[model samples]
Target: MKFQVIRLRTLLLSAALIAALFVFCLLGNRAILTVSGQLQQHGTPLILIDPGHGGEDGGTQSADGILEKDINLQLSKKIEALLHARGLQTQMTRGEDTLIYDAGCKRMREKKVSDIKNRMAMIEAAPDCIFLSIHQNYFSDTACCGTQVFYSPNNEKSALLADAIQKAVITAVQPENQRVIKPSGKEIYLLYHAQVPAVMVECGFLSNPEEAAKLTDEDYQNKIAAAIGDGVCNYLNNKQS
Candidate 1:
């Protein structure tokens, strides 16, 4: 009888130990799955900064000969620096005064097309990223001079990002600016077809003498860059929240 009691106690203890281990493993797996899900949902994304117009395509030009390409590159570089200072990863489409086109492209038209195609390929190749294209605006009236943001229609988050940038710029620099964010149309080749979140910032109108002068100023460029960087950071923080 004593032997029988001892065997039963041993069996009960073994079963208890097995049950405890099973519960522990189940909880551990749940914790692991939770962490994995969080990482997948809120992964850090690459910031792809594209400076519009380069090489032969000078884009819009100010009356005083301020090339749009130069201003775009300047602002893009400043913005990249600001973002980097805040510990964000960024990549520029063109860091120099050259076009990114395929070899063997002899004509201007071919080069422009190739350059755009290559940029699009870069956007698509990034597994997870945000596209920010910098460009200057122009109008025949010459009086239209305020920053505008256009967002991609392909991604739902694009509108939020655009709004954040618009508001940030308005609040930080152009307090009188009343321009709102707009949805990018077919005319914008990159934003129109981008599968990921994309936005084009028409920093200001080069046609307007006042705005053109400001755009060329180093201090104003820094302000614009800081505002843009803040906008991007705000968007990312809100997304994580």
Candidate 2:
């Protein structure tokens, strides 16, 4: 009587628990499959976004204590999201704030060299991929502020891509920007040696107090990311036609 009722109740509870778990897992898997399908259906050739200067090397700094590495990472992430939303396949170098050097490299100089070499290897591995390196500029004259783009000199597509991105940024994000795209010099080892189209975006000058504030804002960062995404889309569309 009473004992039989308790046993039946326990069995019912266990069955309910099992059914709930099954439903949860089923829904989760379906969600993953949907996203995977979306990515595969519209994916483009890989676009590698490298957020420059990580780990111990904090590239540049502003008067207000903002670090360039942090800014680069934040902006890169935003750009990645925007590009993905537009159905573009994207990859990142050093997704976090860490130097991606070979494990055995010990000294600071050795690590820096290893980091760049490792980055170059990634670029070579995806030979057909486009590369976008995100960085901030610092000048002795704080008054100098605007977005400037540098492209690999040897690749004609690199120049076109840089020009498109610069134009997009100026028109969409910073109307006052008047900077032009230039050929990357030998100082940028990765860009100079890159076989594929490569461009480095100097987002803004951290040396300027006003521009530094805008760079740190979430809204402004999204605008910049959207502008970059538009530029990449424009370049890709133009390349196809």
Candidate 3:
């Protein structure tokens, strides 16, 4: 009986030690997560997402008739879902397919001007917001493919966001893309006028038959948007840190 009791006592002591170590590990992990999170909020300004094109503004289309506007809206919505899951604040330029223009003139130039005004209004409303405009590229040269991130020449921080996003794009999808983050001049009206940190992302080339097909696929679109969301999250968290 004495021998049995000693064995039981030893076993109990060992179990107790194991439990205590487990608790210590759990607490240490929690502390690490907390500290890392706090460090990431380096400078979390608001974020405004612009889904390029709308209503009548059906941007570049695939030969198959898929409108770039539709693709932009879908991808932006997906990004919004991911951002919301991470507890990040985001604002989209337009949620629907409706035109930014009220009506009357349907001229391309007139409508584009009105859209620019609306986009600027959104940026002005959230002066401190980081701006992101989602778009797809189309060129006569089908060879030009892959995601390209462009920053406002006027804002230095915009370049950071562009680089961060480009890194994510290359990492997630187009690993072969050689194009780097470029500056948007007068050709991109919104980037020129945006007062906040701004970047316009060309998710892929619509002119390339294969790329166009991929962009139109719902699953592929989700992947693209998710990659973008992940990049934005990393950038914002790092900025805060």
Which candidate number has the best lDDT? 1
Predicted structure 3: lDDT: 0.82
Clashing pairs in 2: none
**TM-score-based ranking, best first?**
1, 2, 3
The top-ranked prediction according to TM-score is 1
Could you give candidate 3's per-residue lDDT for residues 179-223 as a string of tens digits?
899999998988987867899999998888899899988889888
**Which lDDT tens digits does candidate 1 get at residues 4-53?**
99999999999999999998787554432221122122245778899999
Sorted by lDDT (best first), the order is 1, 2, 3
Mark the 10 consecutive residues where model 3 has the least summed lDDT.
33-42
TM-score of each: 0.83, 0.82, 0.79
Candidate 1 residue 209 C-alpha distance from true site, Å: 0.5
Error of 1 at 95 (Å): 0.4
Q: What range of 10 consecutive residues in model 2 has the weakest lDDT sum?
A: 33-42
RMSD of each: 9.1, 12.2, 15.0
lDDT of 1: 0.90
Give stretches of model 3 more than 4 Å off. Answer: 1-42, 103-108
